[model samples]
Structures are given as C-alpha cells and as structure tokens.
Target: MKKIVFLFAFGLAALFAQAQSPAKIGFADVEYIFSQMPEAKQIETELQTLQTQLKKQYDGKVAEFQKKLQEYQAYGNTVPDAVRQNTERELQQLQQNIQKLEQDSQENLQRKQVQLMEPVYTKVGKAIEEVAKANAFTMILTNQVSGLDVVLYADDQSDISDLVLKKMGITPQAATTNPPKK
Candidate 1:
C-alpha cells in the first residue's frame, strides 16, 4: 500500500513539472527587416542628399576661413598693430562659426533620420507584435548591430523574422543561419 502511494505522488509531481514547461521564445533581425522595406531606401537617399548639401556648406565656410587666415598671415608684419589684432579676432570668430555649423549639421542629420524612420519602426513593431501573438511566442529578441548576436542560441525554426515581414505585407526572405553559441 505504501509503495502504491509513493508511486502516485511521484506521478503527480512529474505531471506538474510537465505542465509548467518554459515559454516559447523567438528572435528577429529588425535591421534586416528594415533593409528589406522599400521606404528605407527612400529614407537613405534623402539622408544622403541632405548630408551632401551640409558638406558643401561646411566646405564653403572652411574655404572662406582659410582664405582669410592666409591673407592675415601674408600681411601681418606689414599691417599696423590694431589692424592685425582685428583680423586675428575675426579669424577666431570664423573658426568658431565653422565648428558650430559642423555640430549643428550632425545634430540635424540625426534628428532627420529619427524623424524619417519613426513611422517605419512603428509599423515594424506592430507587425512583430502581431506575429508574436499569432505564433504564440512568449518573447521576441532582436539581433544587435554589426552582427552582434544578442541571443547566443535559438533554434533555426524559432526565427520569426519572415513571419513578421509577411505580416507587414512584405514577401518573406530566406532566414539567415543562427549565430553560434558562445
């Protein structure tokens, strides 16, 4: 009788353990998905054009500053003290302006990129959520930049990137192989 009771308790414990299985996990390469989107190409082109324009403006200012500096150096010894001092001050101001413009250009470019990509990111996020729910995934991870794998090991079958693209109305591409375990 005691043996039978022990066996029953052991069976119940096994059943409970089986019922509490780990949640299903999946991963997606969001950067890959963004690259696949047509809107991303447009954004890239727009950003490139803006960057080129900014570069030209910056170059013009730099050239102007260089010319002024050259002029000052050529005439510094001949010029009166007051004139040399004024030219030096003007050159310093120009240099500061160039630095300010460079900083502003960088900040502007970053702001524009975020503005342009915000909508696409929102759309992709929605698709990921939909795919996760439809496929019963408990959590979804994203691959890091420069091929840095945030997830060391996930089964190949657990990649839901294709499904997410499909949900976003884009055709699914072949899945890349999972990163090797650390």
Candidate 2:
C-alpha cells in the first residue's frame, strides 16, 4: 500500500511540474513577410500582365459586339427575314461569348494567383518553422494581419514576424516590428 501511494505522489509531482511550465507562444505576420519578398513583386507583375492581356481580349470582344450591334441596327429593317434572324442569333452568341469570357478571365486570374503564390507560401512556411524551432516557440499563431481571430491578444515581445522575415533574407520594415495597439 505504501509503494502504491508513493507512486501516486510521484506521478502527481511530475504532473504539477509539467503544468507549471509555460508554453512559448509566438505570432508571425505572414502577409507582411510575403509582401516584403521579391517573389511577391514578381507575382504581382505577372498577374498584372495577365490581367492586361485579359482586359485587352475583353475590350476587343466588346468592340466586336458593338460593331455588330450597330450594323444590325443600321440595316436591320432593310435586311431579309432570314438575314435578320441570323444576325440576331449571332448577336446573342456574341453576348454569351462576352459573358463567358468575363467568367473565364476571373477564374483564370484566381488560378494564376494561387499557382504563383504556392511556392512563396511553401518558402514562408519553411522559414516560419525554422524560426519557431530556433526561438524555442512551442506554437506560432498567425498575426492579426490575417483576418482570422485565432489570436485575440499577443504581446509585442511574443511577435516573431521580424525573425521570420530575417529567416527569409528580407529586412522587415520598422513599422512591422511594432505590434499594433488594441
């Protein structure tokens, strides 16, 4: 009975010790880190170029649509029934094509954004992991820059965002080092 009691007390003491140790928690602003990265600028330029091309395509289609519409209106009354019907169908098809292009362009832009950012995200993720491990942080939460409410409040000392930027070889901006006020 004494031996069992001793084992129970030993276990309780161990539990108490473990419970007393505070977890090292830190926060990183991934968005800030990503913004400071050169890859982000490249991605933005590429996306802009793609957006410009898509816009040009959209503008051309609208011009074509407008031209057809004007032509139909100009000679619509003089044209035969069959020609009028065909022109109307063509105009309808062109409208559908324009709408389809708008949708496709939006989707394409989103896909391109994700594709371009995938590598950046991976690189940042690796840097965050390294920083957390090196700093002895048990858990790192996303800073308030993210729309998530995971972290309600965090001390300035607990912010490792600058460390993460340094890990990625980017100099963090001075403003970013300072945590925002509540």
Candidate 3:
C-alpha cells in the first residue's frame, strides 16, 4: 500500500514538472509561402504559356482536318466511291489522332505542374527549418490537418508563415489567417 501511494505521488510531481517546462509552439501555413514567392508569378506565366501551346497544337490540327473534309465534300459524287471511302477512313483516323493528342497533353500538363512545384516545396521546407531554428521554436507545424481532422482555429499571432516566406525571399500576395477574435 505504501509503495503504491509513493509511486502515485511521484507521478504527480513528474507531471507538474513537465507542465512547468517551456513548450514553445509555432505554426506556418505553407500555402501562403508558395503564394508569396516572387518565382510564383513566373511559374504562373509559364503555365499560361504551356496552355497556349497546347491550344495552338489542338486548334491547328482541327483546322487542317476541317479543311480536308470541305475539299472532299465539294467534289460530291464526282469522286470515285473507293476514293471517297478511303478519305472517310482517313478522317476517322484523324479524329482518333486528335483524341490521343488531347490525352497526352493533359498528362504532360500534370507532369509539368509537379516538376515545377517539387523544387519550390523543397526550398520552402528548408526555409521553414531555418526560421524555426532562428526563432527558437520547440515545434513548428503546418496548420495541422490531421487525417481528415483539420484544426479549424489557430491563433493568427502564432502563425509564422510570413516570417518563413520572407526568409525564403518571398513576398506573399495574401495575408496570413488569424484566429477569430473572441
């Protein structure tokens, strides 16, 4: 009985000691980091250029196919039956080619988005580490989205997002979120 009581008392003391220790917490929203970077604008421009290129490719092919169809239709019944059938088959093949082009372009666009963002995310991670160390943070977290459970409320003052972005030489276009004032 004495041993059990002593153990309970010791556990209580340990808990008290832990509660007194410094637990410096910090948080940064990485979405803001990406938005604030100067290179972010450059990336957006590049994405637009890619879209224009894909559009040009698709439109050019479609226009060429339409022109050929018009030429075939103008000849009407004067064209030999076999030759007309062959042209129709070629037109079907052209449609298939367009479908393949669209599918390939979509996949390539996704690939480009990943390629461009991966390095930016890496740089942001390193900047986050540097900011945490410099600020003597015990633990730094990203707005804490835990497996389908998001932390909806965070104190804005606790948000170190701007600091981290600045450290990375980024200028955030938007403001950081602050907890609702009670």
Candidate 4:
C-alpha cells in the first residue's frame, strides 16, 4: 500500500510539473474582458428578459400540471386505482412537456448568447492578438477561475489588460456613447 501511494503521488507531481513548465507562457482572462466591457450589462438584461418571456408563455401548462398534482396528492388515499393511474400518467406527460420546454429554452438561450456576444468576443480575440504581438508574447494563457492568475509575481505594470481593451476600441464607461432611441 505504501509503494502504491508513493507511485501515485510521484505520477501526479510529474504530470503537474509538465503542465506548468511551458517554454514561453503568458496569461489573460476573457472573464475580465466580459466583465469590464460596457456592452455586457445590456446583453445580460436582454438574456434575462428572454428567459422571463419564455416562462410566461409556457406558464399555463405548468400551472395546470401543478393543479392536477395538488389534486392527486390531496385524494391519493381516497381515489380509485384507475383514477390514480390516469392522474399519474398525466403527471408524467406534464413532466415530459416541461423537459421539452426546458430544453428548447436552453437551446434558444445558447443561440442568443452566440448571436449577441460573438462580436464582443471577436473583438476580445483581436485585442489579445494585438497584445501578444505588441508585447512579444509567445503563448498567452489564463487561470482566471476566481482570483489572480499564477504568474510567479510578475510586475502589475506589465499586465496588458488595459492595453488590450484599448486596442479593441472600447472606451471607458465614463466615455461610453449612448444609444439612440427609435
């Protein structure tokens, strides 16, 4: 058991070392771009409204299902077997319908996300390329799950997020242009 544990630990260490030992490496987080972009809040609001609309449109079926389920539960001990079976069947069908609606909503959300954010994402890609070229970066990466990226204490002045955002033609929130009303 000790040998097996030692071997496992050694293997994991070797794998981690290999992963960390890139010859030329850089790091940037796309999350930062999205969070900082002025367009992101507008897109998020649109996404929320779309979800709300879908829920409203499909609410009747959901409400009916809930009502039937309540009735079935209330009469569970008193109802005839055939009535119980029929209610169960209807409940199953309602669940399947709910599943289909959920799937459709998810697909629509994905499609809308692509449509709405592709342009912004494209700009971010271009900006990253510009940063890499300007800074002579060989490989830019990211470890931006929540906190600061692992960079062995590089200079904060060396961080190029501001430069990348500038290159993308994105103005600061204070300088953002207002959209014209229809």
Best by TM-score: 2
TM-score of each: 0.83, 0.86, 0.73, 0.63
What is the Cα-based TM-score of model 4?
Answer: 0.63
lDDT of each: 0.88, 0.88, 0.80, 0.75
- Order the numbered candidates by TM-score, best leading: 2, 1, 3, 4
User: Candidate 1, residues 1-182: lDDT per residue as tens digits?
Assistant: 99999999999999999779888888888887887788988999999999999999999999999999999989968999999999999999999999999999999999999999999999999999999999888888886657787877778778787788888889865545444364
Find the 10 residues in a row with the least total lDDT in model 3.
144-153
Clashes of 3: 1
Tens digit of lDDT per residue, candidate 3, span 32-118?
677678777888888889988998999988997898899889998998999999999988888888898899888888888889888
lDDT of 2 by residue, 1-66 (tens): 999999999999999998899999988877778778879889999999999999999999999999
- The candidate, 1 or 4, that scores higher on lDDT is 1
lDDT (Cα) of model 2: 0.88
Off by over 4 Å in 1: 1-19, 145-147, 174-182
Candidate 3 off by > 4 Å: 1-26, 133-149, 171-182
Stretches > 4 Å off in candidate 2: 1-16, 145-152, 176-179
Predicted candidate 1, C-alpha RMSD: 5.3
Of candidate 4, the 10-residue stretch with the lowest lDDT total is: 173-182
Q: Which scores greater on lDDT, model 2 or model 4? A: 2
Please report how far candidate 3 places residue 89 from its true position, in Å. 1.4
Which residue pairs collide in model 2, if any? none
Q: Which whole-number lDDT from 0 to 100 does residue 41 have in model 4?
A: 95
Residue pairs with backbone atoms closer than 3 Å in model 4 (clashes): 26-141
